[model samples]
Target: MKKLIETIVKPLVDHPDDVRIGVEERQGRLVCSLSVHPEDMGKVIGKQGRVASAIRTVVNSAEGAGRKRVRVDIMD
Candidate 1:
């Protein structure tokens, strides 16, 4: 799960090395915290948050079997 987020976000960022993801299990839900370079924050989030939404959708679809709720937080 972490790798999937990394793979999708890393390439789009100007600083791939700065892309970091942290996963935490809270109340049976998975929360993914994505940290990217300041310069690439807008890119990962996209206009009106479309990119963030897409990433969450992919995570949700991929975790269908487990029915785990996934949330993505784009952090500066």
Candidate 2:
């Protein structure tokens, strides 16, 4: 799960090394808190949050991600 997210966002950031993802279980769901360099936030989030939405959709639909609900949150 972590690797999937890293693969998705690394190339979109100017500071790939600064990208971090924290995984936690919350209310029976898998929560992924994603943090990226400030400058790359916009790129990861994209216009009107479209990119972020897309990412979350993928996470939710990913096979082998388990049956638990998966959430992707962009953290500042």
Candidate 3:
């Protein structure tokens, strides 16, 4: 899951090396935290948050992720 998020986000950021994703299980839910260089935040978020929303949708649709609650958080 971590790799999946990283792969998806990295390409959208100016600083691919700065893209980071942390996964933690909380109350039976999978929480993914994504961090990128400040300058790339807008690129990751896109217009009207469409990019972020799409990212979350893709993550949530992944195999096992569909059966569990997966949350994606884009952090600065």
Candidate 4:
């Protein structure tokens, strides 16, 4: 799941090496937090958050991901 989100977000930003993702399990939920270089925040988030929304949708629909609640957080 971490890799999946990385693959989707890396190319959208100027600092691919700065993109980081952390996964944690809490209360039966899978939480994925994404952090990128400050300048790349807009690219990762996209206009009006459409890019972020799409990434969350894909992660949530993954085979095991859908079984539990999957959340994607784009962090500053």
| Local distance difference test, each candidate | 0.90, 0.91, 0.88, 0.88
lDDT score, candidate 1, position 74: 84
Indicate the worst ten consecutive residues by lDDT in candidate 3.
59-68
Model 1 regions more than 4 Å off: none
lDDT of 2 by residue, 1-76 (tens): 7888999999988999999999999999889999999999999999999999988888788834558998898998
TM-score result, candidate 3 = 0.92
- Give RMSD to native, each candidate: 1.0, 1.6, 1.4, 1.5
Scored against the true structure, residue 52 in model 2 reaches a CA lDDT of: 93
What is the model-wide C-alpha lDDT for candidate 1? 0.90
Question: 1-76 in candidate 4: lDDT tens per residue?
Answer: 9999988998898899999899999898888989999999998888999999999888887836338888888887
- TM-score, one value per model: 0.93, 0.93, 0.92, 0.92
Tens digit per residue, CA lDDT, model 3, 1-76 = 8988888988777899999888899998989889899999999999999999999989888836347789999987
